[model samples]
Target: MEKGIIFDIRHFSTHDGPGIRTTVFFKGCPLRCIWCHNPESQKLEPEAINRTKKLDGQEFEVKEILGRYISTDEVIKEIETQVSIFDESNGGVTFSGGEPLMQPRFLLELLKRCREHDIHTAVDTCGFAAPELFRSILPYTNLFLYDLKIIKSDKHKYYTAQPNEIILNNLSMLNQLGASVMVRVPLIPGITDDEENLLAIKEIVKGNNSIKRLDLLPYHHMAKDKYRRLNLPFELEDLEAYKNERLKEIELMFSDLEMPISIGG
Candidate 1:
């Protein structure tokens, strides 16, 4: 009975991976990126949160619990219920985080079970785990939604609260092993979207064929409300979501790459 803490299990998700899918968001993370959208997913334990609800014109306060420990069998049952939908849409389950690799044993078990069910699997990771962790899960994972934030070591450390050495090394290892990787870059306004950082990322994936597509994720302030609910400060409260025109220009930067470039997720 292997159990892992999970904060969310989102169904019919189009942005996580191919077709329609279910994204199983594992709780706990190594890197504490300032612009984290799912601030609730950062901690490993269950969190009792105070939230506000409105009916008609009146406001009411409510209590909600965030993360919970669930058995692998239980999680598999939930995934099995969506198999029909998965089959019809070429969709399957995606294990995402607060860095799923943080719980290696539990994650490995889920991946093995998903494999046993003949389900297409993807791991949305920050690439901050031990190299061996990636190697162990490589066989079970069909695709990887890898996040590559700041490339400069100092800035990467300053922003993510974790050095990029392990992350970069793990990515290089994956590339060497010919893993199917879709590099996702979170375009945080001044931090990650700078010309220098973007260009540095371009250099990393320049010649890699195993690296599939590039997803340029522009920052948005939608999570401010979530932060408010959790009583956490929204660091980028004043930052606006990127406009279409600027996003297009940034998209054009990677226009010549062999792999396709998408603007979101």
Candidate 2:
């Protein structure tokens, strides 16, 4: 039996992809983005998201949680229970992560099984995984909520502790594949809200017809407290959600780009 380390699983989420979704948040990530909301999912540092997790119909956690390895059959069975809901809502399952691609094989099999069950699938990724890994699984993905942290190389590294190489490459591949994609950029007040980053993102999206929508997720400090809970230092404590007007300005700027401007999920 294969069991992948998991931290959280959210159900009936209408935001990630189309319709209602069951988001499977896998544990582990490659980049250390300061503004990461799911700090618990940011590391392979799996133990338990909650020593006493409440398991109900809507939210299900495996009874015997272990290491990052999980059986593919078991996961598909859990997903199958939601098929009726998925069918009604036209929403499927989303394999989110600590960077879902971090466990490439696990994610691939997960996605493959979802497809076999005739479910719509989406991958909420930081867009930082290896190119080959991305190519192999994307064929099974119905939609992608690809995150755009920073466009400039140096700025991106400073913010996420990683380069934009693989990230951008994966985005490009998504464009090339004609895959349904929505570009999600965190509306950080100082770091990501700059003219350069916004403009660069604009250029990239404008150049690709594959992208037709942009979702701006405003920054929040709600996740800061998690760092304290987990004994991890909060790196983005200084940042707050961008002002309403500033966020509107961003939306207005992209409004001219001829895309649907979804403010939030």
Candidate 3:
């Protein structure tokens, strides 16, 4: 049996994608976004020993606890547990991650199985993967939740440790290829919410009709507590969250665009 490292399986999740959906959060990420909420998902490692203590009130030097990666057959069985919920809610399955494309082979297999059952499939990605990876997976996808960070090369690198070259390239290719994609912008207060960067994002994606809709996710310090539990320091320390009114104001720049913009992701 093949297995993939997934840190979370969130059911009845609406924000990750369209409709009511189950979000399968895979482990490992290439970029280091200082505002990341799920810090654990960024690492290939399972939860550390000390972190387990806080979750379960026990302490240990090392914790190799097995994670839940349900079998292909079991996926539908579990998904059925909420089938009525999905039907009523107009939702399906979303493959999210540290970066789902990070585990391309496994994700491809899982998505194949999901499609055989006619489940709607969506991928939430950082657009920081190899072009071939995106090419291989696009066919299996129904919708894409593509995340674009800073537009300037240096600022994008400083915040995510990756230049925006490949990121922009992949997005452009996806658009040309006619993928049904939605652009997600994490409006981190001091970093992403800067008017300059936000305008840059608008200009970068404005012409691409394939990614007509935009979802602005407000940044919060909620991940700080998680970082502390894992003995990791959050680099975006002390960054203020962008206020809701501010997010609405920023959304106005894209007002001329045809598709509607919604705040919160």
Candidate 4:
């Protein structure tokens, strides 16, 4: 039995994929995005996160475990409980991260098991993995929630610790292979939401017909407290979430692409 570190499992999630979904948030990531909301998920190993609460003007702290090492069978058992709901709603399981590809073998096992169980599956990826590793799981993945951040190489490396070369290459290959991919662009203010980045993304989508949809995920400061819980700095603390008007404006940029465009998730 292969065990992997998972930070969280979100059930009844509509934003992760079509219909309702159970999103398994795998721990660890290769790239360090500045505006990352789940700071606790970034680490590969199990760690403790501090949680503080104020009750009647008194502060109390509790330690919460961020990661849990569970086998593939263990996960499948939990997912099995929702099999009926998944069938009724056209929804299934979604492997999200901290880059699920970071735990390739473990993820592959789960995908295989999901296929055996006759469940529709989805993967929310950062698109920063080897082409072979990515393609290996394609047959099992029904939909891909692919993340496309900064298009420019320098800017990509500046925001995320890793370069975008591999990410772009893998995406192109996925397109060439005829995969169902929905490009998810994180609209981080001052970082990923700039005009140059949006235009570049437009060109990328314009060239790739494999892209089924383009979802503009507006930036939010809701994860600021998560950073505080992990004792990590929230760089985007001063930045405000994107207004609906601005997100619609960004959506207009892709109107010429002739693909389904949505603003959230």
lDDT by residue (1-265, candidate 4, tens digit) is 7899998888898999888889999999998999887777788999876777669999778888889999999899999989888988999999998999999999999999999999999999999998999889999999889999999999899999989999999999998998999999998888888898899998898898789899988887678876765566787778887788887788888888888888886
Regions of candidate 2 where Cα sits further than 4 Å from its true position: 47-69
Task: For residues 38-149, write the lDDT of model 3, one tens digit per residue.
Answer: 7777876565434534437665444443244555556556776777777788788988888988888888887887787778889999999999998998888999999988
Candidates, ranked, lDDT = 1, 4, 3, 2
TM-score of 1: 0.97
Model 2, 13-109: lDDT tens digits are 9988889989888888889888787776776854553322334645343333323555778678778888899999999999887898888888888
Q: Which candidate leads the pack in lDDT?
A: 1
Per model, state how many residue pairs clash.
0, 9, 1, 0
What TM-score, to 2 decimals, does candidate 3 have?
A: 0.90
Q: Which TM-score value belongs to model 2?
A: 0.88
Q: What TM-scores do the predictions have?
A: 0.97, 0.88, 0.90, 0.96
The runs of at least 3 residues in candidate 1 whose Cα sits more than 4 Å from the true structure, single-residue gaps closed, are none
lDDT accuracy of residue 239 in candidate 3: 72
Where does candidate 1 have its weakest 10-residue lDDT segment?
Answer: 221-230
User: Which pairs clash (backbone N, Cα, C closer than 3 Å) in model 4?
Assistant: none
Residue ranges of candidate 4 with Cα displaced over 4 Å: none
